[model samples]
Target: MTVEGFDGRLDRYLSEVLSKTRSFVQKIIEEGNVWVNQTQVLKPAYKVRSGDIIRIVIPEPKQLSLVAQDIDIEVVYEDEHLAVINKPRGMVVHPGAGNFENTLVNALLHKFSGKLSSINGVIRPGIVHRLDKDTSGLLIVAKTDEAHIKLSEALKSHQIKRIYYAICEGVLKEDSGVVDAPIGRHPVNRLKMAVIPNGKQAVTYFEVLERYDKYTFVKLRLKTGRTHQIRVHMSYIGYPLLGDSTYGRSKNEFGIQGQVLHAGEIKFVHPITSDVLHFSTELPEYFLEILNILRSRNSKYHV
Candidate 1:
């Protein structure tokens, strides 16, 4: 693409403009697929001036060899156009990185028998949105490309409602609050996200459901969906979610594997029927067990 008002490194501009990962842009650059002003620019750090005509040639995606595995998944609702599933904690949404099997996609592949939308490519066949591996929640999967596009448009317009429940590390003084912050990849830790000044806009509205001496149960609603938005925003406000090793304390007495965040409810308009659909799931057993423990301790302390 031709450079316009941006004056930065070629790779950074491409990553931001195309919404592709930095690594992917770098790979393409190294492969000599990017040209600036009709000249091949292999270096990722090549500075580009305004009005520089940049061209990129993206290669076709390779045929994925992912296999369907027969794994159990909780299907809350299903129809010809879409499926709403209550994904359990510890199950990756789709195959990626080191996790290539036993994921939600694998299960869906088996259940649907390969009858899923291919809009997101083979690896993430029907997935429209994602939750963290440790985040148990409701997810909508599109059965066809038309439904996928409609659902995607709904998400873009902020019409879909996503609500989450989380256990925070500290008692929030306010009963309700909003965290308006920008989130981006951490400058130091690549695996984690952080609140950066130049990051994408992220807003999270939270209400304190219950408060203890050192903990708070909060309900969160997302105004904008960004990667790790809740975790980054809560940590930025000094009320990190309990058991969030990347953003909060690494060790906790609750014996939780990851952060105690659950996508409790989702409401959206059905793509095909044009009817409002809502789905909710109860908290996972492990989360409830921890809550019970906290309640008992809280009562004892008050007594």
Candidate 2:
């Protein structure tokens, strides 16, 4: 909520506006659940400005334990320090909020057990990065804490390379271009991201691979990793990815279940050995089939 004309202490304002007790507002604030302009405020007497945006995240009850199910995950590569996985589409990476069981973390826990890193706590053990639930492709997991730290540093410095392939909703005329937009949470919808002026820097470089009459096959690379960067940027440019219901059409012509995007390639330096590493994978059977269907329509349309 953005404060307007209210210039007073946070607790008093929250208590009156939310109809909660004074002690309750103070308790949540002291627990670090309240934020003023994206910074957590532990002080109840923190003064508020008229334009300050306040947010509060009430955490859910913690799960007792994570279940290690016998879920099959394709381990593309592995070493003492790290592992690469070809994560399938429709699989949640980690369990949280309305999702408790049957996640990649559970599958990895079942397979790797004590070998995975614990830097991200029990809920997200070994997870150094993530792909959306509907997106498929390669992912890297850390085996040791030292490896995790180094990999995280590399990612923060934009040294890690991530490449993607997608079938978008429209034919892009440009052969290659970049979408450099600032991305932040939607003003109205908290669940979605949008291109906003006061958002984080998000850059996506795309090259046209095949242009069909109705859609375009494109390869993309990320310069900066923000949540839903590619999907949001593409949609902002008026060519949302096929099957991206959140930012684009809910129902597409192909009837694909999720967004037609895949992390097909990744490159990074080995943490322990200091060796450069690169990995790539073919498009999934379903994505390839869709491309073939578009290709068979006409060779002239594809430039």
Candidate 3:
């Protein structure tokens, strides 16, 4: 690809233009897969000038060492190019570090077998985006590399719509508002994310759906998919999610394991057919039960 008006670091420019992550681009650059002005460039920090010609060679997918397990998964929709799954709470999206079994990837591997895309390598087979382990909702898996690239590009350009439902701890005064905050890894606690000045751009638009004395049910739409964007932003505004142990109160009356957040809906255009597709899933049974209890309590207070 030829550089246009960008005059920044090579890696950042390529990551923005190609819709690939910075880390992925850096890996290929280190492997000598990138060229600038017809010269092989190995450093990710190389500065680029306008009109400079650049080329990136994507390598073939490598063999991954993972076992397929017969785990149960809920498939919302599936076709030749992609599959949408309604992931349940408590299931990790993929294996990592200490978690090697009983993940959604294992279930996909068992069900699709050799039919998943390999762009994400062994561990994440067909994963295009991710949801936190405890946040249940819709997730898309690519059946082929072509679809994966298209979907990834769509996500980078904000063409894909992801809506979430969350039960926050406090009643928000506004009916609807946008949380425009940048998110980065927490400086003090490496395991957490926070709204820092130099963090990646993140925006979340939320609307109040129901309001109780001490809790508020809201719908959130993600404009940018930064890590833990909603959780961090909500906490920053003093309405942390009810059961979020990381960002909210440690003890919860609901007796839930994780945050009360759900990926409720996803909308995107079909990669090959160009047809618009939308999918949504209902809240989990436990979430609804808590809402009912809250409603009963609110009614008693009114009476």
Candidate 4:
């Protein structure tokens, strides 16, 4: 990519282009992965000029000798090439800050160790996509490098379809709508995401499924996936997800843990065989419980 528009420090410029955090870009630059005009620059604050050719190297993640625990997980579909797993709430997708064990990666390692793909490194072998630790849903895992690459490209191109079900804090005035917004780190709260002008493109289409006295159940389709996208957008539009402590109300009104969101459906073409594959999952017990309570209250229903 050619540098244009704005000129600033090398790391700052790359962070905007890649839609990544400055610290993350700085780490890569420090590791000698970025070159300006074919000359490597180790300092993050190195000045960059407009029209200067910039090349970046995104090396594959290195394995960190992840552990394989005897944790149990549900595999919805599996072939020699890939597998789809239903991740339960509260389980981290992989190793991350302050979490190293008892994650979905550890469980996958226990069951399919040698057979999983290494594109995401040993820390997250076989993992292709992610669901937040509090979000219960379906995820894909690649078994080979080829499958990993193809699936990743498919996700990047938005060829894969992902659908989610969530319960938010109020009735949606419109029957359906779309939230097209740009999301970036919050200016005041660094730990949270906000709709910023310079943030990456994000879109979400939502249809009202049911409406209760104080809450609404909706089906959401992701047009472009970004970190905390659905949660951030919904909150931005004044319909924050119930139990969403990060973006919504922190009060435990419904006695539920974490946000009441779930990835209920996914569809995509098979990477190797070119076959179209679709998968759906039942909403977890927590979601069902709330819906049931709402149903008993004589709430309005829609398709």
**Can you give the lDDT of residue 35 in candidate 1?**
93
Best by TM-score: 3
Give lDDT tens digits, candidate 4, residues 168-189: 9988899899999999999999
Instruction: Give each model's clash number.
Output: 0, 0, 0, 0
Which regions of candidate 4 deviate over 4 angstroms?
Answer: 1-30, 33-64, 299-303
Candidate 3 lDDT tens digits, 129-181: 99999899999999997898788889999999999999999889999999998
lDDT for position 124 in model 4: 72
For 1-303, candidate 1 gives per-residue lDDT tens digits of: 678898989888997787554656888899999999999999999999889999999888656578888898989999999999999998999999888899999999889887788668768888899999898999999998779877877887899999999999988989899999888889998988888899988999999888878899899999999998898899999988999998899898776668999999999999889999998889998889888888887875321
Worst 10 residues of 4 by lDDT: 15-24
Worst 10 residues of 3 by lDDT: 294-303
Best-performing candidate as measured by lDDT: 3
- How much lDDT does each candidate structure score? 0.88, 0.89, 0.91, 0.88
Q: TM-scores across all candidates? A: 0.80, 0.80, 0.87, 0.81
Ten-residue region with minimum lDDT total, candidate 2: 56-65
Q: Could you list the CA RMSD of all candidates, in the order they appear?
A: 5.7, 9.7, 3.4, 5.8
**112 in model 3: Cα distance from truth in Å?**
0.9
